[model samples]
Target: MTGPVVRKCPLCGKPRSAEHAPFCSTRCKDRDLMRWLDDGYALPGPPALDEEEGKA
Candidate 1:
């Protein structure tokens, strides 16, 4: 059987249409940009340690 259809927009969790296969619409795409600009999203990474860097 075919894998579960994964045709939803990653930014807005809406079904992706042919015109905007990865984003429901241009608006949703812009919304994702705004979120980035406003720091609504975050990246997972290791925390900085002063001791490791011989700073403390």
Candidate 2:
């Protein structure tokens, strides 16, 4: 099956067009940058659930 459609910019929920396939506009793209600078996004790690730890 074909992969899911590419997403638009997170800051502005708009369809990805040819001019800005990923981001609707430069402003939206920059907004994502601001979020990174402000540490607004975080990559969650997997929970530590080892079998050995449970045994203890």
Best by lDDT: 1
Clashing pairs in 1: none
Q: How far is 19's C-alpha from truth in model 1 (Å)?
A: 3.8
Tens-digit lDDT string for candidate 1 (15-43): 88778657899898888889999989999
Could you tell me every candidate's TM-score relative to the true structure? 0.57, 0.53
lDDT against true structure, model 2: 0.77
Local distance difference test, each candidate = 0.83, 0.77
Winning candidate number (TM-score): 1
Off by over 4 Å in 1: 1-6, 47-56
